[model samples]
Target: MKQVPPEYYQKLEELQAIDFVIVELTLYLDTHPKDQDAVQQYNQFVHHRKKLKKEFEKLFGPLTNFGYSYSDYPWNWKDAPWPWQV
Candidate 1:
């Protein structure tokens, strides 16, 4: 497996943490829809996740097989190292 920079894993860990918070907040909101504070936090996390995902994809290729992360020149997803491989 090819070596990746430490920052790559750092970003991935940050994204994962944000995703975990979002999921937990979503579940909470399902039961407490009136919690405005939680709703605001959810939105903030969502935006943050999008920004992180964009940055990650730009440097490390698509995290998923589908979506806007696809590349045209050499099909980065095919050539880039997978998470486990790193």
Candidate 2:
């Protein structure tokens, strides 16, 4: 068994928090599509999400599956307990 580092969980939580904001922004855009500020914010969050995911994958293995993420072994996010379960 492998012992996961504490930072791994921290980064994962950060990613999840960003994802939640993105989702809320998505919903806002669906109704306020003409808001430029909202659009820019959404794009910024998206960029942050991409960068964070890449850093996380590099340190902790792939965070996704189906070839979307690269890893020396494989995307182990689905290997055991779900992120929420941890």
TM-score of 1: 0.88
lDDT score for residue 33 of model 1:
100
C-alpha displacement of 45 in model 1, angstroms?
Answer: 0.2
Best-fitting candidate, scored by lDDT: 1
Q: Which digits, one per residue and each the tens of the lDDT, describe model 1 over residues 1-86?
A: 67789999999899889999999999999999999999999999999999998888889878866565667577677766876676
Q: lDDT of all the models against the reference?
A: 0.86, 0.83
Best by TM-score: 1
Q: Compared with the true structure, what per-residue lDDT tens digits does model 2 show for residues 34-83?
A: 99999999999999999999998778676777788765755356554435
**lDDT for residue 46 in candidate 2, whole number 0-100:** 98
Q: Quote each prediction's TM-score.
A: 0.88, 0.83
- Measured with C-alpha atoms, the lDDT of residue 68 in candidate 2 is 81
Error (Å) of candidate 2 at residue 3 is 1.3
